[model samples]
Target chain A: MTAATARRDFPRAYGKVGSLHRERLWALRLSYTSLIVAAIIFLAPPVYMLMTSLKTNAEMADQTLSPWLVRSPTLEHYGATLENPLFLGFFANSAIVTLLVVSITMVISVLAAFALSRMRFWGSQTLATGVFLTYLVPDTLLFIPLYQIVGGLGLLNSIWGLVLVYPTLTVPFCTWIMIGYFASIPKELDEAALIDGASWPQMLLKIFIPVALPGIIAATIFAFTVSWAAFVYPTAFITRPEEMPLTIGVVSQLVRGDTFAWGQIMAGALLAALPPVVVYVFLMDYYIAGLTAGATKG
Target chain B: MSEVNLRKVVKLFEGGVQAVRGIDLEIADHEFCVLVGPSGCGKSTTLRMIAGLEEVSEGEIWIGGTMVNDIPPKDRDIAMVFQNYALYPHMTVFENMAFGLKLRHFPKDEIKRRVDRAASILSIGELLDRKPKALSGGQRQRVAMGRAIVRDPKVFLFDEPLSNLDAKLRVQMRTEIKKVHQAVKTTTIYVTHDQVEAMTLADRVVVMNHGVIEQVGPPNELYHHPATIFVAGFIGSPAMNFIPARLVNAAGALTIQLGQGLSVPVPADRTARYAPHASKKLLFGIRPEHLTETTRTDKQNLAPITVDLDVIEPMGMETLVHFRIEGTPVCARVDPAAGAQAGAPMRLAAHMDQMHLIDADTGRVL
Candidate 1:
């Protein structure tokens, strides 16, 4: 409640009223303090990376400058990273894997969601719960077992193996997101389509797809970001520098046991984070609408 | 236009709960039939069974002389308007109307012509380019109707189609629906819980209660000649009041004795018809409009009683007076100039000719 309203509720209690105003001031102070602290906590690393990526190597080793600021800014590392064929291959591999995995995940999730939410059959509820439950599995616990399966298929050190294991991380949650969107739609809409002579496939493509477009975009972001930033699966599956995605390639190749190429590493990290940031920025509204629609279905 | 028929249709849900208990009805070609009742009364369920949206646990549903028990809704050649309108939110009004015909593989020119014609018939031609979400509630309602009309199906099914509109819009749309029905000449079955809507829109009204048909007749017939006490009470506004009384022999004639020393002679024509139930407890039925402030007029079948009016509500066209008869609350409609006052004794006349005597034990009217 506002201070003015609180005072109006008890006009004669002078000391208590003072304490109420004090309490509100303390709350506002604490909230802004915590918010600034959180913003620093989340933003410090990215800012440091950008600052370091823009600094010359001489400024980095000089030991007389603030590490957070660049005295002389240059784009040398960005140019050098782009020119390196190995780094370019890493970018290409990450893009290919993300594209394939996202397309595959979307197809599987949208169909699974439609069947589970609309064409409900025996055990469908159990199956839907099972799909969400799979998303709860941590990647650290899943990687070793996936390692053996990748080795058995002879896809070791291949980006193709990463393509196979990525959907395990992406599909279950995408399907869950889509299921919430599908279930939120009113039941009568489908009944209307049925009376309108729409066949099952026709109903899905024309009605559910267009109506639930926001959910689809949200799920696409999930798949895109997950596959693009995946580290554990690619670390376990690929060993060759050329076969590695950007996540594994930057970390493994940019460090030589003791010395680090800080500039190239920061440049690579920023580059790797760009696509997801772009996807998120361009489609932020749909993502929020999708998440809320799923949450408030009932 | 094609006739629709239902024979012994039943809807038995899972867990042994019955929603509809084997009721039958028939609507003539081009007839506007309405199924109306209180909520959970199976009126909508019966309409769904006819539209093939609900399975009829055991009976035949015939549309245009064809049994459709095994047919899916898409193949049933019927269109239904939902209470929520159920217009496809993503589609333009024109596309929503044409989706059905497009699915049936109608040519593009034919689809456009049909959509345009239906749009004009509903006077929603300007709204055809807008999405359903962009239109007002009444406009969305028209788009839904346009979607149904463009198909030109064998039968039209409407499940409380106008329940979402405000009262003024509901009355206006009620007239709009009637006008459209006249223009289309399609056999339609509509469902609503509002009795006023049923009375105004239906060529035939079917009153349902507790999974069974209570009565079926034209609106005026059902109002004037109700066969059961339930129908009598359900058919009128302000409701028909039922006071506990007894059909007794009064000086070798039949008189219904209401307690508090109030009694009225049965009209001569009905005395022989009611004689078999003499000396039995009965319910005296009278509509609020039939009970009014007494004046010097034809007293052929008039009965007078003085009551202490408890509440008087002045509705511009008529004043309603409420009081109790032997602890049974009752209401009467009188001329607004009748000077009804609360807590004042007033004499009101009840027309005995329009009165009904119901058997209390069986709820049957004589």
Candidate 2:
């Protein structure tokens, strides 16, 4: 049936004149109130952060009522933070580790998830549920045990050690996302590929991976953000000044016997937070799509 | 194109549920064979088994005289059009058609040539670069057919490819698919529940019930002389009316007595077939089209049929009268020109020449 015919068949009921006008006014009032409340609640912290990042170390200490709009906005703090060689090294180190971790997580999860979602064998259902549940286990609970394992492996004070440990956290979550994505692909598409003379590997690489690209992007964002913002593991495993990831590397150097570089510290934090923020800006659609797949496909 | 053959093929699923009971079939090269039945009657399972998508729990399948029991679907040399038109959603029509050839490492030019040829045949040339998501349902169905045709496989398997289409588009695609089959002439097997599709498309229709083949024959054979009661009932729209009766000999001719002071003569040729089984309870089968409005002059052979017209459905060319008889509900197709009325007595002339009689107990033709 045509949409026009369907519309004619089930005509929309019109509200009475009094209620219709009342509803419009009521909806407008509610929308305006929510927008104002939301703007303040959500934008307040980031605006404050922007003000703090703009201030000099002395201005930050000065108690002022209107701290949000800096009277004299200066780029000195940005310059100061950008000038530190050690800070630059930390930034580079975070980039390398997060990129490697995201790449590794995506590759491994895509393969593992395709297998778990598509291939059938004994214990497959158990193994898939087990993987998703593993992601649910709090990372903090395993930090001590994981630290001990890293110590035993003699991977202390190394970025490689952080890279190795990051996958343990990212793989399960990313694989879970990918499993849902791969499962949502209609079973017929793969059957078509299989009958098209594609082997299992070909089916995954050619058909599934391309079709589930949104999920892959979401998985990558999750892996990259988790690796970039990881504070506990890097702090526990890397003690050497040169070995620290940027999150720890910046904070540890900002303190010199309690005489902290507050301006540089916020600057470094802002810089360290930039990549994930940028990633979300570029791929928010896929991130939201991938997240919803878990709820719907499950 | 290869002739497809199955020898006692059975598919017992993981939970020991037999989706397809033992089935044996053979299709000659370039023949359009339709496996048709109601949903979950093992028709799709049988097609999937022949495509090597499902494993045979027992027996063997041969495509082009090669035993393919252990082979994966990729090596089976078959192309299947799924009910959902399983075109790769991510790819354009060109890529969807080219994927199989690209996987086989077909030369780029050769792949393009084959795809273009199939596209022209399907008249989807203008839509080649559009993704399946961008196309209408009928366009997507044509793209799916184009994809199958580009493969040039040994056999073509269609699993109700037109089920998703609207009625008008379905009828159009039905003819389109038939024309494609005629042009390609690949050994084809189509599965559908609509008997009209089976009758119009198949060189031979395999009617199934409860995972078992009820009957297999040409469409006309099935319509005129069904091998069993299920086939008789399932093969016609406004299905064959089965009236309970008793077979008896009256004055040297076979006659069926309907209990309600109504008796009709059976065909003379079929008299000998039921002679050995006289006085047995039988199910008298007759198609709706074979029953005409009884005129006074033709009352000699007409059986008395009383129907309390519950509903009247007019389809332009004919009118359908649904009512009850012998305490059992039945449908009769009658001429619209006769202007049958609701809640009124309508006399029907049950044509005895085309009437069928079967043993009600065993459901076998007597």
Candidate 3:
């Protein structure tokens, strides 16, 4: 063999390549291996849920060692889950409440954030910090006190109660996120707009809102997800069956005392998670930017 | 065109930092007035105050006979080009140029026509569809100029607009701006720290230092007849040389005794200006180019000094000879064929006609 061919065949060649390249290759191999292993470990539970959702109850209960595949896949669970009047009602109520709550949160948060971020006013910085601090308060601890307030306002057992309560959890975080996002826009851009005869409202509408659309999208996703998957306040305040959102409705109606309807519960959980996933899929760039704007600006 | 008048304008920041102090200027119609100074000399703050971008702490600003203290930038009938070009990155060049006109509710056709005309004037018509980021730095600068031109405002404000370009492009744009000013003849107030730009582009230059007006005059006038010692030192490239000397009246002739036994008799006409200040110390100032290698044929009031040469830098047309007299370093521009060399003695005739005597104490020109 020629020297090049002989070296290639010997498998001990390319001595000039530094050790850093070999180390980097090893590191990349380990990273990919760990990444796939971690993904499988974390995803196994969800995969099992989906698998069980597709299987009949008989196949699901059959103590088979290999649970990855089913002899008979069925759509009974999807049909039953959709056909159930309570489930359908809860889905509709959840949709309406989540949409309304997210809408209200978006409107209030964006306006308040624009003011806090762009407008120079007394106590604005302090008020903005206070908004973030409010987000730090655990919802589990505040829901009890919020329940009495909601009940005192005669909004108990009503979707309005959940709608009003949902914003309490979402607005602070959303507004805080938006404030940071809006603040990241260069001050010169606004100054230019102002010099161009744009009023404060016009500056925000023409320059800021358009430039910070990504942040607003991320905040919207956050608020929508929070409102959709929220359980504590809704379960506490919304007691009526028809008024129930999906999170509490699935637990109360589908899973009874000692007889758990895992398929429907999993289906409801998957549907409840779908909106945020779809939103993130569509606007992941903005969501990541909104979350990391503080780091970038700093 | 419009005239801008500022009387006793002072700007004090919140932290008691005084940026502009008691600045008084009058820019006539179609005049290209340049406010030139080093950084922190209040030139920009003064321009911003006139543009209504910065609040005037104490002053009256009148544009075209109307006081505009509280009027906003938009109402001032002026357009300003910032140092960074400040073009809207998201907008196309056409849209960027059209923004001001559209804000005034100008007709669509008029806005388009004005933008197109400005684009043609700036030769950016083909680049109109491209965003600011798509254009080169010089192209973006032209787009900014086009935006200002499309406004057709009474005045234009340029805040160190060429500072962002490289040296070669800056020189080219300086000429471009001068030609544009000549074509439009709109009153312009430009601020810059580059003395070369001020000298080349300004109809009249305002030299500022430490929040005060050091001097104001035409470039050549400031170069030749600087009213103050600061202006003399600040105006020229290689700056005017300042040498301490003793002024005395001896034998009915006013003469200055420079160090190293050199004396220059002052002219009879100009000597009368400082005749009373005899026996006082003064600063003898002269430009490097004014010191000639050729001898003085008049043979009166001429000062010849022995220069201990440290280095000789030769250009094609002239040579810069570095030397010292009385421990103060000095440079003299001589013809390249003069055959001056390093570490050698050279004699230069200090032209008394082109010299200035400044007060040693207060630095006021005599």
Candidate 4:
């Protein structure tokens, strides 16, 4: 039966107000209002960033023009930022570090999750909980100790230092997400594969990986975003402009002793944010599916 | 050659819960055997041990004369269909059927031929290109069976595969599975809690309860001659009624005395057998169909009883009337035209020819 007929048969659930419950509509209106307010509050900064990136330096400094509006917009700041080789070098460094970090994190996390969830030994349960607990630790507190390890390796002023320390930020949470996905797969599927004549590695590659693709995509997006935008590790280790990622590179290079080039800084920041935004736009469905995997039956 | 033998098989889970306690069974080649019982009765556990999914804790499992206790599931040459129809969500139905062959490195053309043949057997040819998520529940069940049939393994195992389908679809698939097994002629072992499915599909039904086998025989034999009270009650629908009574020697004829001073004489042929238990308190077991309206004739063992009908249910072809025998509830399946009604006295003919005398202390039928 349709829900409308069900509501008619069970009318007390709709209350004495009939099919259109006034109290329900009021609750719905309040929820939508709060959702709209939350959306605007979260979106204001990006919208303002785009406006500033389009504005000319003269328009930005003018006392009469509103900072929110870009009157007589120019692409001069964008063109100048692209032409600067120092800016391009920082972008390349961030891209390479993110690529390496994400790959390393996925390898470690998938193997760790498969072992922790399926291959049981002593203390396996405790180890799985401990992996998630590490993700809860704030990275701000970790960067100080990680600096010593990176410095002890004699790699203080290098981009490799960020690559070395970034997995500590990404692996714990990615493994935690992967463990949830792996555990949710019914035990029968693996048994069915085993009966179908698949070895353990074959089952992992052909069955588990394809079945858990959404979780892997979600973890990849997380690792990419976290490594690309990471600031504490790079700032603590690398002082050279060429060794810096986009997060520390743009801020330290653009602002000089309170002489802030607001327009160029905004343009450079927007350019650096393009990759992750594109990733989210293309894979938003899978990301949401992965996050809500254990909350409901698929 | 493909017969299966379980010699004293046992499965003891951690912390001392014995799921299957040293049960022995022999399934002949190409015979459809169903292990049926209530939940947690070790029926599914027995099927899993044969499939090599569960380790045999204490005994030998021989399949095709090969003593497969050490063999892995892949090397054991068996295919299983799970209850949920564990089709890979990402692969098409054709690919799902071809997975076992692909894993074992069969040639591409050979895999395609086998998949096509199995699809035709299940009539799922049109659905071969669709993923499992796109199919209905019945369609998924068909694909799961198709996956098993494509392998041409020595034996087929099904673990309550039809429990997920609706009633109508389950019956349809039941006929489909029997047809497939007949065409393929593979030894098969099926597990289910449904007695009707067991009776309809199996060549021999194996009834299990609490980690042990209760009885194993053909369906007709089990219904006509159950060895114990559990089998007598578990086999038939509306179930067999067990009324408490006493066996007495009444002037050289053995008669059973029920609680309401109603006495039923044993048939003359059973006099020698029941005379030994003449003074023992026993349970008189009679099926509902055997206790009907007082209209049946030509039976020398017919005995009459008057009962006040407490509830009468007209079920189109047959009417089920519930009555009491000295405070013990008894059901009778009479013809719908027998004029049975509630709060009225009715006369029922008890077929003493089919009556069973049981030792109440031991639950064994005599």
lDDT of each: 0.91, 0.87, 0.86, 0.92
Q: What overall lDDT, based on C-alpha atoms, would model 4 receive against the true structure?
A: 0.92
For the candidates in turn, chain A alone yields TM-scores of: 0.90, 0.88, 0.89, 0.91
**Local accuracy of candidate 2 as per-residue lDDT tens digits, B1-366:** 499988998999988899988888889999999999899999999999888888899998999999999989889899999999988888999999999999999999999999999999999999988989899999999998888899999999999998999999999999999999989999999999999999999999999998999998999999999989999999888889898888778789877877576677776677788788886778888888777666523534456565568788899988888777667666777888776888887887787767888898999866
Query: How close to the true structure is residue B249 of candidate 3, measured as C-alpha lDDT?
Result: 78
Task: Name the 10 consecutive residues with the lowest summed lDDT in model 3 chain B.
Answer: B294-303
lDDT of 4 by residue, B13-118 (tens): 8799999999999999999999999999999999999999988999999999999999999999999999999898889999999999999899999999999999
lDDT of 2 by residue, A47-118 (tens): 777788888767788886467667667788789878988888898889899989989998999999999999
Give the DockQ (2 decimals) of all models.
0.85, 0.79, 0.42, 0.84
Count of backbone collisions in candidate 1: 0
lDDT of 4 by residue, A184-208 (tens): 8888889999999998888888988
Error of 3 at B36 (Å): 1.3
In lDDT terms, how accurate is model 1? 0.91
Clashes of each: 0, 0, 0, 0
* TM-score of every candidate: 0.95, 0.94, 0.90, 0.95
TM-score of model 2 (CA atoms): 0.94
Tens-digit lDDT string for candidate 3 (A1-298): 5976776676656555334668888899999999999999999987877787778777777895468876777878888888889988998999999899999999999899989988888999999999999999999999889989999999999998888888989999999988888877776566666667777787777677777787888888898888888988887897789999898998888887788887777776666667778887888998887789766983
Ranking by DockQ: 1, 4, 2, 3
Candidate 4 docks at the CAPRI level of: high
